[model samples]
Target: MNEKTEELRDIFTNVTDGEETVTESQTATRGSLEKDERTIDERLENVIAQMRERYAFETTLTDEELIRVAKGFYDDVSDEDLASELEVSSEDVFDARLSLHLVESEADAPDIDLAAIRERDAADLDALADEFDASEPQIRRARRVAAAQDESRAANDRYRDEFDSILGDSELTERIASDVREDGLEDATEGMETDVSL
Candidate 1:
């Protein structure tokens, strides 16, 4: 009976010892996982802080400075070097390069002068159209509008000359001219038909 009691006690002790060992192993693993997670969080926070600093610095640059930095990037400078020099991120340097390229392309485009186009003669306009690789109809339309304006000015000048010529004549002659103009005799004469049947 004493031997049986001792064997039972040893079995109970062994089971408890196995449970304690497993619990300790589990606790150690959990602690290790928590430490790894904390390290990762710290590293991520540090990277985020650095990114914020770079963004703030990049935003402070003027457009001219950005263009200069972009130019330097295109001039074969390394991205890391440019970022260090400009105190901005490599991403910001890439964006500056794109913006500078857009600005330069717009600047390189030719400016159109519609007024100058309107003043050019048909032959000159055709030449211009050929030079600009434009369609003939567009050139013709500009020429037509310019010609119409010219005609209108010439008509105004003729009327002014007529009025001046009449101003130097007698009052009776001026009245006759005025009456003829008001009666539309100039237009009437052009449309009149002569009757030859008697």
Candidate 2:
């Protein structure tokens, strides 16, 4: 090779530290289809520990019960069902849900005004229930939902955030979506045959 070319090669080698291959580390969690890595319950237990360290507990539920609540919430289990399993009042489950930030947007009744209940969060439950023509449970639920939503608006809902962080990825998702559109959904969902082509 010419002297000029040899010098250019030397410069390139220096820049790359003489390594020809470049590799990037994959994300921490595996993709959805991977098998036998870690059970969802085990993973959730770990996440719950991390979250508890970051935030204080205000609910009456024990640490073990908190894990059950987090697991049940992720499994899409209803509060009433969790209450039955835990042998606790639905009110306790509701309180734990708020403590863990596992709240979903819901109203107590169709005509219930969340804004009105939010303003009365500290007011007497009996008076609010009477005024709204709702049960004490309904008023309690409305207050929790309203407060959680209001807080979620100002910051990310960490529990829902846990799902996306623990199970999804934005950059990889976009790239995969683009590739699927370019390749066609049928080939992706059903395996493409090599012999069949346009």
Candidate 3:
């Protein structure tokens, strides 16, 4: 590469070297590197690496099996977390999840009854609070929502973020928008019951 191109590369390295923040002077040049530096594949790989570092929980299962097991463990965890648990790449986790859906479709795996789980979680949390002999209002409130619900709160959060991104404008007047809002309201009331029965 030429001098300018080489200089750009050095700048990118500096930017990603865990610098505090991007300054105004670097913004324009930074944009070019940001646009070109990480491809979808590379970013995805990095995500997988980060995930693996985060969840490394104990499990003897293979990546694919581990993903399935992890899902059963919690409905709210990101596939990245699952990937980490399974000691695999996020892409692998994605593929495994897709396969799970396909198999679920064939087997008619019952859609999770999130409402029931939430109610159960609440009950369990209540019991735990009683058993512990001390109850904080905040703890009671949170427990009431997920006393026994499948650990899918994280998943629900992800979906919420994704939904918001897709919706973009918050101005909701359209019928579809109304429906979406209604669904979200119901979900909230149900305490993260996004894993409804299929």
Candidate 4:
């Protein structure tokens, strides 16, 4: 319907007739179509390259956000096309889809009582997991994460208590801190030679 489309149609038509001689006009149209197609392809490639660069360095997009974007990209483009556009493997795309499902499932999961979990034996935990209709491994992972957090909190409390005890003697604390700073500075500068004559 457009000039270029008509020209392309004509080129294809001429090709189907194997015995027909290609006229100068048809030859020129064919070249023009190829050039135009190349330009369009180059533009598309440039855009995809820019998108890939931005996506790679974008720190604001969380895993969930990235998963959603990957899903959207996969839906709109073929696996090979999406992989080429994103400069990643098809396996990476599959992984993103899997991550999206995992994140969604995690979001839909019910909250567990971590304190009650800490009190429970292994058998009790398995029973609790059954009661919650969750997998034992999932419950175990949550419990492990919660226990690690509790351990971190306890370590922080101990550090705070130690610091408080140290601070109770202000003069001794200041002297000790000053000595540590001086020692650190000396060690840091030990390997470096400075020209102070100028």
Candidate 5:
């Protein structure tokens, strides 16, 4: 076993009082994206629980203290709320505060707009349909599908662009370059098949 695995096993051993022996398989999978391994979040939560016993007596902890505590409890509790309750500064709460705020606020807020959005006029919709020159139902369905496709394409393109940079090595050049040069070939073929099917 590597030093890190040994260290982790040691730490795990120190934390757990139960007669759980650290297996080689367990150490091998630690910090890996394997299904069997405990997630960093789960391991951290366990560690935090062990650590929290030391601070549990404090009625309130400061933002720094809250952050220190929360660093081991990522995505577990509301860091901001804990920070506030602990009398910690907003800046001291971790970098995930923004994401947490967005998520929490979104959850608490109404799903649909409380205020009504103005509906598109019949004439406007008709004009849009006419502009497309397809059957009204077909045009509406196609528009929705096209919008979704555009979003999917954009995401795929972004991932591919990032992948291209990493895959520019000489050994992978031919395959990646050919793939890029013939990009959208499958989609084009699928479109032809779809037209025939329809």
Candidate 6:
């Protein structure tokens, strides 16, 4: 592993106490997009617990709620829905999400002055809405997005790094490119076979 690859490999060390599987596709077929000894929810819960201890957070929500925040974020569940489900206020849900480092949705709209909106999170929402020609809810969402970006920057996104590593498989990709160039067979898919197979 080079410097960057090594840094990614150094992340969270695949559970110090976990099972290892190196099954062959021909021998055993597993169905997850990526096989893991721990399920996603289990891993999310563990990560939340670790974050709580590491950051010395004093959140009142239980372990279940923290896991929900992590899963809910990706599931596209709004803060209002999450708050309703947890029987907590939206602010409490947002705080819990940030506390778990579940923040990282950023707005990149050219029309909105996101920086100004973020800077004045506590400023009058009505004035900001008028200045930006956006609704109060829109400004509020922008503020939340800004907060998520700011908070998520504290650490590298682990799953994204994993995806990058897989997508950047130079060995396999280089071999495929070399074979294609060596064969001098342009348009490999131009007139490929489309017959039935068992």
Q: Each candidate's TM vs. the true structure?
A: 0.20, 0.52, 0.25, 0.25, 0.19, 0.48
lDDT of 1 by residue, 72-167 (tens): 533557656888887888656644443222112222223433456665665786687886676666565444444433443544534223322332
Residue clash pairs of candidate 4: none
Error of 3 at 21 (Å): 37
lDDT of 2 by residue, 29-114 (tens): 63544243666556656766765676665677876787788767766788899999999987798777776667766522446788
- Which candidate wins on TM-score? 2
Minimal lDDT window, size 10, model 4? 99-108
lDDT of 3 by residue, 20-132 (tens): 45676554442121233544334433433444454442333344464353334234566577678767786565444432221222122133333443545554756554644
lDDT by residue (53-137, candidate 5, tens digit) is 5323222443345334444233355656656765665434432232111122222222322111113343454665565454555
Rank all candidate structures by their lDDT, best first, as comma-separated numbers.
Answer: 2, 6, 4, 1, 3, 5
- Give the best candidate by lDDT: 2
Write the number of the candidate with greater lDDT, choosing between 1 and 6: 6
Q: What does the lDDT come to for candidate 3?
A: 0.43
> How many clashes in each candidate?
0, 0, 12, 0, 1, 0
Residue pairs in collision within model 6: none
Give the better candidate number (4 or 6) by TM-score: 6
Q: After superposition, how far is residue 70 of candidate 3 from its true place, in Å?
A: 16
Between candidates 1 and 3, the TM-score winner: 3
Off by over 4 Å in 2: 1-39, 62-64, 107-111, 124-131, 164-198
Distance from true location, Cα of 83 in model 6, Å: 2.1
Who is ahead in lDDT, 1 or 3?
A: 1
When 3 and 6 are scored with TM-score, the better candidate is: 6
The RMSD (Cα, Å) of candidate 5 is 23.7
Stretches > 4 Å off in candidate 5: 1-76, 89-96, 99-108, 111-198
Model 1 misplacement above 4 A: 1-60, 102-198
